[model samples]
Target: MDSQHPPSPDSEQQTTSRKRRGIGRIGWAVLGTVFFGSLLLIGILPRLSQRSELQAAVKEASTIPSVDVITPRRAAATTNLELPGSVVPLNQTTIYARSTGYLRRWYADIGDRVRAGQLLAEIDSPDTDQQVLQAKAELAQAQANILQSRASLAKSVSDLKQARANLLIARQSWERWQVLVKQGAVPQQDADTKYATYQANLASVEAAQNTVNSDSANVKAAQASAYASQANFQRNTVLQSYKKVTAPFSGIITARNVNTGVLITAGSGNSNTSSSTSNTSLYTIAAYDTLDVNVNVPQSSSGILETGQTAQITVRELPQRVFRGKVVRTSNAIDPNTRTLLTQLEIQNSDGVLRPGMYASVKFAINRTNAPFVIPDSALVVNAGGTQVATITKDQTVHYQKVAVGRDYGTEVEITSGLTGNESLIATPTVDETEGLRVQPIAQTK
Candidate 1:
């Protein structure tokens, strides 16, 4: 606001020095601001670039899916096969009477153990006894007739010898008479009478020879009759032995159809008897020293079953017991309708714990030469292309491989034709995990 005055020299110098110092301070301040701004820009540019790179890496990692992988496991060599079977006695039979008679007494009853040739019952048949006696008498009479005929034959032979002697004498006399007639030493009538006597002697000799032949034929006929009578007697004696009922084999009697004084018919005729109408047989016997189990093996497993193969048998009634047996025989032919093989297994039942007609379950251990691989059901992928399994390649890429299934367990499946049991399989594959897609594999814990 005041008017300016002309400056002296010293004062002018002082004002000039002060203006220079203000200019220097402004220049230093501008330089310091520029240096600090450059430093800040340099630090911010590198950080921004690093942040961009980190974001890019995170985005790339998010694009690839992570998956849990498992290796396929191999199946076991032996498989257990279970089947139903029927238990039966080794030998069973229904005994019947061979002769018709009333049961007098029974030595064996139901549930009785008997040995071979043991008497079970006896029948008192008066008719059969009388028939046996009559046959014996007829045989004796026939033998007597044979003896008488033999004596008559001897007498006839002696008569034949006498006849022969007389024939020789008559022939000699006839020749002598003819010679005398020719020589005219005797009368013609006497010579003719001697010739007639010789002819009569010849006729008598022929009759005697015929009588001897007839008597010899009679002896032969009597002998033949005696032989027939003897055969009849022997047959009757055998029939009489049938009155005693005996066991043909050692066994246990399971049934008793006849008691004392019960009328029994011969053979296995009609089952309707006056005593009991329940069964046709006199007794049912079974030899249960051993037991037989019969099972029908399916065609799929028939080839693996063989004779001498071991088996385990179990019954529902005997839940705690397991019986061991072996394959004894087979039908050797397949059933057309059932498509099964009839197999028989034998088991020793010396303890008598098993009975006939019992239901049993038979288990067989079958070994497989070509065992397949087993994989979890979750690893399987079924698509329009067919059955497949998702696997991870070495390069961490998704791969879908075709697999053929064999046996299906509930939670696992058998790979029969596809897998080599060395591939890393995905535990579960999603739709996004297509073939050839890159994925990050994580090992799955069992």
Candidate 2:
């Protein structure tokens, strides 16, 4: 119908209107395409930039292993260390007879509590008593002999005086005979006889003097013999006193192997003769007023303990008890075979609750003069060489440090000789970690 109407003026005007409408439609299509294209570009440009950056970062990260790191915590001034231990009596001894004889009577038996001087048993030491009596009699006899020798000395002195008097009288008689012979009033024979009598009296005086000297020496010998006899008597008396067996210290008797009428030998070279546990002892006494908790502490932790440091003891038998103890002794040396120290803790046991050879746990609160850094237990690397840890420096270089470890608490460990607490430590070092490997350390948040 439009093609037939083209001869009219409306038809020309409609054709021109159609051309304008088509041009308007073409212009709107071009504007819509330009706007949509600009929106698409605006949305995709940032995404593309971000994807490029992400890919670049992945490539960089793949060259280095990412690791979580932790800063070591400063160790406390005092650290608690627990070690397995055994409880023992403070003083233990095996009793043996001091005198050789049969056991006469036992005043204290096994499980008996006795004082230091309490009688434990009696020995029928008849020979010791007989020896004491004999010594005493010999001493008395020696004293009597000394007295007799003194009397003989006195008699010899009297004889010497009598002989001296007789010599003086004979001298005077001889002098008178000589005068008579010179005066021709006496015979020569009488003068000669008086001279001979004087000479004989002089010889008797010399004999009496020698007898006095001999008697004096005899008295001295008797006195010395008496003194020796007295010493023997005293020594035998001391030996006799040993017949009464007594306790050497205050304690409870743990064992008694001898009874009345048992033949107990004295000073027999057996286990009882020494300080060790005696299998052939008459009795065994253990002092339980204090107990010793012996623990083998690691050499690293041993140096921190001292003699007066207080410790805690937990007994397995008494699970609820926490016994207060003091560090009494230590070997002060590291055992080469075990690499440990023998430490002993002393605990008061006045209540008699603790016994010897009981299982125990000893806790020593040792104060370190130089406290070590504490790190997570997972950071340690143990190998055939020794224990080590991985640390990262400020330059992001991995450093494998040889560390001395102490007091492992499962979650944490003490670095006794390595890091300065400020080092960034790797949680777990890999086998490929070296001293100068560059690493990407990620700080552990927790």
User: All candidates' TM-scores?
Assistant: 0.68, 0.75
User: In model 1, what lDDT does residue 219 have?
Assistant: 94
Per-residue lDDT of candidate 1, residues 263-339 (tens digit): 76777422543544434688788987899999999876798898999999999999999999999999999999999
Go through the candidates in order and give each one's C-alpha lDDT. Answer: 0.88, 0.86
Candidate 2: which pairs clash? none
Candidate 2 C-alpha lDDT tens digits along 1-446? 45553378988899999999999999999999999999999999999999999999999989998899999887899877889999898999987677777778889877888889888888898888899999999999999999999999999999999999999999999999999999999999999999999999999999999999999999999999999999999998988888887888898999877656666666631243223332356778988898898899887766677788898888877889999999888988899999999988889999989889888888877677788888888999998868998989889999888998877788998887877777898998878887899999999998
Q: For model 1, give the 10-residue run with minimal summed lDDT.
A: 269-278
CA shift of 382, model 2, Å:
2.8
After superposition, candidate 2 runs with Cα above 4 Å error:
1-51, 62-64, 161-202, 268-280, 395-397, 432-438
